[model samples]
Target chain A: MIRLEQVSVFFGPTIALDGLDTTIEPGITGLFGPNGSGKSTLLRVVAGLLAPNAGRVTFEGSPVATSDEGFVRRVGYAGHSAGLYSRLTVRENLELFAVLHGRVRPDLEPLLEQIGLAEHSATRAGVLSAGLKQRAAVARALVHSPDVLLLDEPYANLDDEAAALVSCAIQEWWTPQRIALVATHGAKKLKAFAHGGLILKRGRTVVQGSYRERPEAETFS
Target chain B: MSGVGFVAKTAALTRKDLRVEARSRDTLPPMLAFAFTVALVLAFTLPDATRASAKVVAGFLWITVLFAGLIGFARTFEVEREEGALDALLLVPLDRSGIFFSKAAANLVFLALVEVFLVPVFGLFFSLDLSSWLMLALVVVLVDIGFVAVGTLFASLASQTRSRELILPILALPVLVPAFIAGVELSADLFAGAGLDDIAARGWFGILLFFDAVFLVVGALGFEFAID
Candidate 1:
């Protein structure tokens, strides 16, 4: 489980995350918010990328710090930007991450196949369409088989086929033993998949419930 | 997931950099081209008398290497920045020191490759003896290590800022003054036929070593904060 206790983040004078508190259980949780509503900031904080000023983010019972090797290894984060080496081939990119994550003789063929990049495994990421690049990013994030996966706008620029590929990948990977939090503006797409979700306004959680019980479910259309 | 050992991580990162450079040719060719161009321009500017002086030749050669290295450092983190790959790098469980050292090692290799052509061309242009050429190689290796040790740290820091092009030199050049002075002084002594036994040459070499040790430590310890 992941828990944020009175978490607050500041970017200069701007309050990116207010004194927000929430608990995220295992399984996929759709993170919905308008632009500038702290969705990315919240995900970054959970991923141990950004440190909150006034609160604590804990995985299980331990605090999440970038310096903590054990904690970091359990987390996988894919930001809005693909976070891939444009110059690297898809296979090389996955292999690099796998090696870094300490997989001796890492088997990347399955991941490439699952992400629908096996055909373009040798192609450089820079030349791929935006949707393909996003798929590569997702594959890289899962190379380690992390326990906590945080994806920020994973389906943003993907085509219908590409989005379906992502949704399938997420469903296959996000088991009960793992926690996956996906942030997206399109709640309708997530309504069919997410078990629960949190809606952020400004820097605070305005609503928290199952998708069907959400007050803004009508607006999801 | 179990994390890779420090040595393994560092080697993997170094190999990744070399592979990327080999395919993309994003860093080395431009660096070599710029260094060669600088050598040509400087060669033309020198008069016959000045060209014959080993001191003048050594000074100009080090200057050319320094500027060429600056160009290389400017692009060190550029590819990562473009795709937000640095965030992924940070996500790796390896120690931040490993990241710093690997990057410095890669930069050192790139600088040394440029020197493979650069030193020979410099020797040919100046008509330097073979013995001086030997000492010049040693100087280049030491000087390049010192340059990349500090350059990698500043490049990583400057890359986080919006004006990375303007910020890298600003952050790096000031800290590199001592190394620059030592490189020029040592190169001049080597070209003047001073062996390692010469006190002047040995003293400048010591200064260069000190600079390398200091900056390497600083870069290893400070890299986490710089990227954070």
Candidate 2:
């Protein structure tokens, strides 16, 4: 589980997140919002990827990544960018990720197959279609089998089938031992895996409730 | 500290980068050709320097390396940015400095390889005798390290821009002039059989070593901010 206490993030004059306090539990937690509503900021804070101008983010009741090395191993964050090696093959890219995380050999074929990129394994990631590229991005993110998965706009270009694979990967990856937070606009389809939802607007959470609860209160407040 | 992990991470980055370079053979071949062409053109244009001095050879080598290294450094982060792998790199547990150093190390190795052919060609054309090949190698290594350290840092910043590739050299060239000057002058002195101690002064080589250390630390310290 992750916790944030009165966290605020500023990009120069622009305030991305304002004095926000929230707890993110295990399972897929949808950080739902409109454009520039600070959904991404909140997820970054919980993942320890961004430091708050004020306040703090903690994991397992301790400061996340108290050391730089500690954080690198503990959190897996996927930003809005695709973040793949365009010139390298999908398998090579995954192998590199695995090696970075201390795995001697990563069985990426399984993840590649899961993401429907098995045939494209030898192809340069840059040459793949957008949906396939997104799938490859997911494969890289999960290659290390991280504890907490933070995905920003993960389903942007995916077709229905690809989206399902991504959704299932996130769902299957979520348990008491691991957590995933997804920041997205087209998150209605994520209702099934999301144990709860945190609706952010104008840099603060307007509502925090279960997936079955109405997001209307959060959107309006 | 995960120093070993940091090394592993750095090696992974270097290997992946080199692999990508290998895949895109066209990307590097043009630069090699361009470097040799510059040397050949200079050789044909000049009267055979029956009296070619070490100073002349030193200047020739530095200019060639600068132009050639600039092209290579500019392209260092291009593949990653285009492929969308930069974000994936930032997501890992490695320190930002580790990323910077790995990139620097990779660039250093590459530029050194190019210099291998470049130096001898410069020597052959200029009719200069490199009395101490070992000393010449040291200066080359140090100078290139300094150049690539700062160059790698600047490349990352430029990689995010609208005119990514074209902008890297413009930004990097101005910042690297001091290091380049030191490298060229020091190597010239050494080639001319100047006092080892005198060459150590701006010994362009020594200056380059100093700059290498400084930039390595600066690049390491500033990497987190740059990548984010």
Candidate 3:
């Protein structure tokens, strides 16, 4: 389990996460929050990308997410804006990231096929459609096979069929040993696929636990 | 997160950057064009006597490089800063210091290529001899190492700001002063007919060497904080 204790993140004078405390358990969990509700910030903190101003983020009861150790081997992340090198083909981007993650010559064909980008792997990320790019971004995150998969708005641009395919892929990859957190504003199928959910309002947990009850959280859950 | 040693990590980073540059053509072309244009303008604009003076000619060459480099330097981290690619880079497991060194290495590669075209044209326009081109290249490369070492650091830092193009020069130029001074001095002596040995005897070369070493180390260590 990942425990967040009084974590707060300040951007200049504005607060992004305000003394928030929560636990991210092992299993696929839906993260639902309205715009500017700190969904992305929370994922970043968990991924070890952004360091919180105060409090601790612990994984398995050990403090992390605030060091230069590249404390991210176990965590996979795809942010709100998909981060891919536009000039590179989807294949090259996946291969490059795999090398950086220290997995030499990784076999990415299966992951690419699973994400539904097997044929489009040769297409430059800049030229790919928004939905295709989103697919590629998902594949990029999974290339390292991280145990903790944290995807922010992975279904934003995907169509119904594509969303369903991605959801199925996510479900197939997630196991009890893994922690899967997908933040979404839409896509009910993906939300329904999640076992539980968390909600944030201006960076504080307004409600969390089984979110299938609330209609709004129902879609992202 | 297997341990890829320093050299392997640096090579991987550089390879990624070089492929992007080779395809996108975002950085090198503008820098080379600006360097040549400035040299041509100077060739026509300067009085014959001033152009003939070794120190003045050396100053013009160094100044042109410094200004033209600004164009390339501003865009060195363009790939990383765009979208959320920097976060992806930070996610990968490696010694973070390798990021800084790789950036410096990539910038050095671009600037050195610019000089390949730049020095010949500079020598021709300013009526300088190409006989000691080897010595001149050595001096320019030393300056290039120091320049890119500091330039890559400042560029990465400035890229985080709202107005990065304006911020890069402000952050980099001050720290680069001593190296620029040493570069011009060493090159001027070479153009003034001093051999490499003679220039070494004066000890200004030490300043260039030390400046390169100090900033290269500082840039690597301080880079983690700069990005954070």
Task: Tell me candidate 1's TM-score on chain B.
Answer: 0.94
The best candidate by lDDT is 1
Docking class of 2: acceptable
Query: Residues A1-221, candidate 2, lDDT per residue (tens digit)?
Result: 78889989999999899899988877677788778999877776776666789998888888874235566676677777667777788888888878877777567777777778899999888788888888788777788788888888789899888899898878766667788888877666677667778888889988887655665533321
- Check candidate 2 and list the clashing pairs: A72-B93, A83-B84, A83-B85, A84-B84, A84-B85, B182-B204, B199-B203
What lDDT is reached at residue A141 by model 1?
90
lDDT values, one for every candidate: 0.85, 0.78, 0.84
Better of 1 and 2 by TM-score: 1
Clashing pairs in 1: none
| Candidate 3: residue A87 Cα off by (Å) | 0.5
The runs of at least 3 residues in candidate 3 whose Cα sits more than 4 Å from the true structure, single-residue gaps closed, are A12-14, A66-70, A210-221, B1-3, B49-51
Over the stretch A1-221, how does candidate 3's per-residue lDDT look in tens digits? 88999999999988899999999888888888888888889988888788899988988877765343545777788987678999999999998888887877778889888889999989999899999999888888888888889899988888988987789778888988899888888646656678788888998998777554555555442
Q: Residue B36, candidate 3: how far off, in angstroms?
A: 0.9
Candidate scoring better on TM-score of 2 and 3 = 3
- lDDT for model 3 comes to 0.84
Q: Against the true structure, whose DockQ is highest?
A: 1
Task: Arrange candidates by DockQ, descending.
Answer: 1, 3, 2
CA-based DockQ, model 2: 0.43
